[model samples]
Target chain A: MKRNSRLSLALHTLSHMADDPDRVRTSADIADHAGTNPVVVRRVLGRLREAGLLTSEKGHSGGWKLARKPERITLADVYLALDESLVATANEDSDPVCSVEYALHRRVSGVLREIEQSLVKRLGETTISEIR
Target chain B: MKRNSRLSLALHTLSHMADDPDRVRTSADIADHAGTNPVVVRRVLGRLREAGLLTSEKGHSGGWKLARKPERITLADVYLALDESLVATANEDSDPVCSVEYALHRRVSGVLREIEQSLVKRLGETTISEIR
Candidate 1:
């Protein structure tokens, strides 16, 4: 559940960010609150930045801040930004010779794919503003 | 995604079993086919047994077999049986002093819980018989 951990970390970090959307938060500051390493915080922040939900400024008095209003961003935005390795069922074999294995893999994968889409949809129902 | 791996293993294993639902296959046989250890196979089978998906027997000519017909079993049944520590969002703190953390956890947890329910529902749509 490492991926889940990251998702939680990002959500919590963003919740804090949502509290003060305009305030700049250094990786150290975020890490301190989350009790995690600054590097980890930076990585997650970087992902959000790339996704346009956050902005990071470099230099002596620079850090991270929300790029948009909290209400504009959804939990789905944070989750989709991270795109962590999926918890999915796939064919274990290199080339499944057995039709049974192949068919099972195909069917399970399709179900998981659909589930992921619905998950994203459900997550989008809640905005960052609503969470905080 | 180890949980997903186990899910895949159980599904593929069951698909094979569906091919010959009445066949008494030992853990060793399953382990060999899945390229995993017998102990691992036994552990997974044990969970399935508890879920009433499969049955186990002891003695010289004993192993594992489906408790019911493949047509009656669904992918959700296999997924539900394992209950592989959910991939969920949760409150990391013992007592979240920050209202932001508390609200985010409660909100995200609910969203993920709903998503899981949808996932199970989607999985239930496909029976083991349909996969193979």
Candidate 2:
């Protein structure tokens, strides 16, 4: 995602969470550290929770906690959990009327898919616990 | 770039250019085929020209022509020429006051850089000539 920092925020907050995996971090606290607002923190972290990478509670002391072991959570896991792509897929012309455009799209999409898979594989090599 | 289709546009145009490498295509024509405007085609092609991937002429009958052999123009050249990143770098908190934040930035930046470089390398492996 170009210039999008949600991944950065998610990773940074998760790195802190990895240090104390059991500790619950309020969205407000994460927002404070991330230099953002609680709503934004919740939005990003919410995606992680939905992906089963995290769990959140709603009480006043409610916050987010790791749903899995720090070592079990790879950067790829967080990246995938966010369910967004750093490399934008050229899905344009899903059905091109032109042959050249069609071929280019097909070939480029294949290459991009390969790169994406490789990227995920590389990311999977590093767990959140490895960050520290 | 997030959801940016400039790469797809450039590659598609160039792939067409490859078919008749010596033939010049007007910006208006490229735009029409790309389902965009001439200005957009000019802008994207301008970047490719700067990267020595393509060349343009002025006035009537003026248009874009491949500056190099299609084999010499790799997707990496086109991608880098855009000077935009598909993968968002975690350059936030460049000067983090917190150590965890600092380490996360450093480590994440490293991982992203690796992915970017690997992406470029993979892109370089495919030249415009090979696209067809």
DockQ values for all predictions?
0.37, 0.39
lDDT of 2: 0.79
Docking class of 2: acceptable
Instruction: Please write out the lDDT profile of model 1 over residues B33-56, one tens digit for every residue.
Output: 666789999998899999999999
TM-score of each: 0.81, 0.88
> Which digits, one per residue and each the tens of the lDDT, describe model 2 over residues A1-132?
226688778887888888899999899888877777899899999999999999998868888999999989998898898876655464564547588666666776666676678777777888888774
C-alpha displacement of A4 in model 2, angstroms? 1.6
Range of the 10 consecutive residues with the lowest summed lDDT in candidate 2 chain A: A86-95
User: Deviation in angstroms for B19 in model 2?
Assistant: 2.2
Best TM-score among the predictions, by candidate number = 2
Residue B127 in model 1: lDDT: 84
Candidate closest to the true structure, highest lDDT? 2
The predictions' CA RMSDs to the true structure, in order, are 3.2, 2.8
